[model samples]
Target chain A: MNAPATERFVVPIGPQHPALKEPGHFEFTVEGETVVDATVRLGYAHRGIEKGAEGRNWTQTLYLIERICGICSHIHSTAYAVGVEQLAEVEVPARAQAIREIICELERVHSHLLWLGVAAHDAGFDTLFMYTWRDRETVMDILETMSGNRVHYSANVLGGVKFDLTDESAVAILKGVEFLEERTHHYRKVVSEDAFFLQRTRGVGTMTHAEALALGVVGPTARASGVARDVRLDAPYVAYADFPARIQLLTAGDLEARFLARLDELLDSFRLIRVLVAGLPAGELTAKRMPRKLKPGEVISRVEAPRGELFYYIRSTGGEQPDRVKVRTPTLCNMGSVITQTIGHNLADVPMILVGIDPCFSCNDRAVTVRRAGDDNGRAWAWADLRRYGIDYYRRIRN
Target chain B: MDTITTQSPPRWRTMLDRLRNWSLANSPWLVHYNSGSCNGCDIEILATLTPRYDLERLGVKLQGSPRHADVLVCTGPVTRQSADRLRRIYDQMPEPKFVVAVGACSISGGAFRGCYNILGGVDEVIPVDVYVPGCAPRPEAIIHGVAVLLKKLQPDRAEEIDRLLVEAGAVVGEEEGIDEPNAELLGAR
Candidate 1:
């Protein structure tokens, strides 16, 4: 057997690692501190959601799809509903459209705050994590009050939103957003100039503007890298067509830039949310009596989920249930960039770089592994087996 | 590791045993493993630990490794590839091991009921003592469910595993009326 002399070993991070909240396996080959190569293996958390959607009826599938990712449940259900509505060719009320957009922006606020907290935790800044999470409760409280549930606020139905925002509800929501707005300004200041935080984020990891465009990354990941592309701005749908938003971008293409982009998006979301709430149209909560069965059609529903662009391709057979429901979540598109960007960074920055994508593992689980020609071992490395092998290998090396 | 020959055991041994069981119940270190979930439950589970829900106030800590965990807080259905690792994880934990299966999918395959790749709920792969059902249950619901399981653990665990199982079944009608058998009481993960 031939082997490299340097301690350039492949360190596998997860299927279940401490850094990653969701299950994802990444095998990184490192020479000392610098990462030489990286390969990500997802599907540690694949629940066959798309296949599950095929069996259930149009109505049942909406609830099922909403459960895809807890953080972005509204976006998933909204995208799916918009697709179904288009397939059915049902006219959604302006009120419903604005309501969906309202939740979408509110969700963005919660999600960005969620990302900030999680990213802070990744960098060993527990205090920052706690503060952001505590303030995030205000948004969660508003969401729960509006839709009756916290995480999976099932606000959207097929043709329109399930819940309507009353003047009182609107008042409560604006108060929450105002509180968040003031807090967001403080966070923006901290991330931009904090000495300790800047050491971990600034110039630590670089993804050039061209690399971002070449990899075809979406959401803040691409926006941070100077690609001025946002689905909301480019292809506005639902209420976005009615109430457009400012696209936030940063050209640094670094971790600090990623943080600032999300914060800027949050600020933008708060402003849009205020607009949607104030200018909320007066109409029926749902569209007029929607037909039970659709008139056979295909619709591609694209919505900006908190992470990035959530693309849902839905095909209907004119039956009750959909023929096929293919979801291409934003995390999947942004994931490739993480693999490419990690190559030149140090091992310690891996968590920061990975979290920069704000990955949702269950969304990106459809994967196939192809074995290399020379690799022959059929041993499945259970944690028990892996732990034992590690001990034995170390023992032999020492002797 | 000696069971006392005398009917009445020594005071020091009993005290130490009491301390161990109390500590175990008070600070239930959990290792959350998502066999195959949509991450609705995983994030909710994580939220349960954050400041708002403050799972730490209940003395709960989310452990990274199974061996260090007292309770296995599992989410989602048992996928074929993950079943082996799920079982392996359950095996790794030292006994009097409690498995709290969280989410509807983990409970009875929820929405992904007949999916080919899914092997149904977590119980199909490993024995689950407490079942918390929700499409993605609120963090508060999860806390209540874990409390139900921890309530059964004795001050000094006596009469081995079988008796522990009997106690788990017996205490369902207490504060949180919902138990493993009554699926009706369960909410979405």
Candidate 2:
């Protein structure tokens, strides 16, 4: 019996492709329209954020980490602050914790809304994109009213929040919630019944629960596949420990399921925000005993962003500045399953599959380049070239 | 052959139409590029797009492609490895482009200055039209800065170009105190 011959062709997704908003390279090996394999090569937007954090004080580091991902800014700051607080053993006020939770949930609303719009845009559903984003403003306005800014709210401080919400802000939040509820329901209908969206998303990028668990997929990506793992529920931190998190799960592991799961989570976040707001504890917004200096210690903290689990590890050397800071974003885990799921899918469905993970390239890659001579060429290299280079390097090591 | 006496629109109408066209042309589609920063400006930029600020209502669209974008909203200081890629993206956009530097780090490297691999602000590599000042400028301020830049795009503002140049630190005559050594290095490059 003769073995069948394998044919390979390369397809490049982007550094500036229409499907992606960020800069990164993804090369797919294809036989016909089916992707045989995929490889992601990032470092396009590396900005040395970790290295830069080394010299900044604990106060400055909070602001720095918040800039890791625009959509996940609150989680980044929350995780960093929690880690630093653990190192210093500083007890945050109850009111501060509740406020943080409220802000975190509000951040989730904005992020999911943004993702909803982007997902719609990816599939050429421009109207849905417009509608979703138009509603997204209400959430941003709510956040801006609470915090001075919309994106990097700068709400989180070393010990607590920099500002407190007034009674009027609470009323504004209630009004926003009423608007969000109606808009979210409309979005839910579109996600479910919109014929074009269903055709584009349904049965595309299907991931089995086992595959997701095996691949270490996290957040909605994993939850949509029936693996009920949520950091907020599992390892409760901040105010989440006090407030019960009802994890939403879906058995269908298709794009629709993932979309539904995110929408459901967004609605749940609205409920969580309202709960925190109604039960607004009266106390200091900051820890009165927060020390100016951080003691020598290392700590790790994890929080659930809209995307998934966000991990932060920090080491303080009894100095004003941190010795080291490491961030492992949810996208890092979610990106792994992309190659696995994208195999056997059409080229047109590629963008939808990629956006399903809501991958944040900036959070994953932040190194500065020291250009080597050979890397400066204009000639494009495919995944085959990368594979060949890897094999050659392995062979040299073996020899 | 009979002579045709038809003429173009009256001067006032022409001027009004030109004004409308100028505003339309200056209503840029923004494409955000995060070269790497903590994320402070990223959220603020997103906030500008959200309903309270509603950048789209102002005719600003957040595009996914550099080719379709009129303005590049660059956040964070450029990292060493991302420099070439950033240049590639900038080159991909069409002409008559504007780059808005968001956040203190993107304008003057903020607190991330003197790092081993940071290029210290995006303007070192790209020509920036406006600089929004803040550790991360408020979304309202970002909208204001972009509005000012759009206003500067009007043909009648040609006389104001010199003042704009000076504000952007692009004027050749000024020898004002150089803030960061990185700016000098960027100039040399």
The numbered model that scores best in DockQ is 1
Model 2 Cα lDDT, one tens digit per residue, A295-389: 88899899998889988889988998999898888888898888888888987888899999988887777532246778765454464764476
- Model 2 error, position A321 (Å): 2.4
Model 1, docking class: acceptable
A15-131 per-residue lDDT for model 1 (tens digits): 766788777778898877789998876666776678788898999999888877878888899889988988887899999999989998998999899999999999999888889
lDDT of 1 at A147: 91
Interface RMSD, all candidates in order, equals 1.6, 3.2
Candidate 2 off by > 4 Å: A1-8, A366-399, B1-33, B37-73, B92-98, B134-153, B157-189
Residue B109, candidate 1: how far off, in angstroms? 1.4
Candidate 2, residue A385: Cα displacement in angstroms equals: 22
Each prediction's RMSD to truth: 7.8, 9.9
- Residues forming the 10-long window of minimal summed lDDT in candidate 2 chain A: A1-10
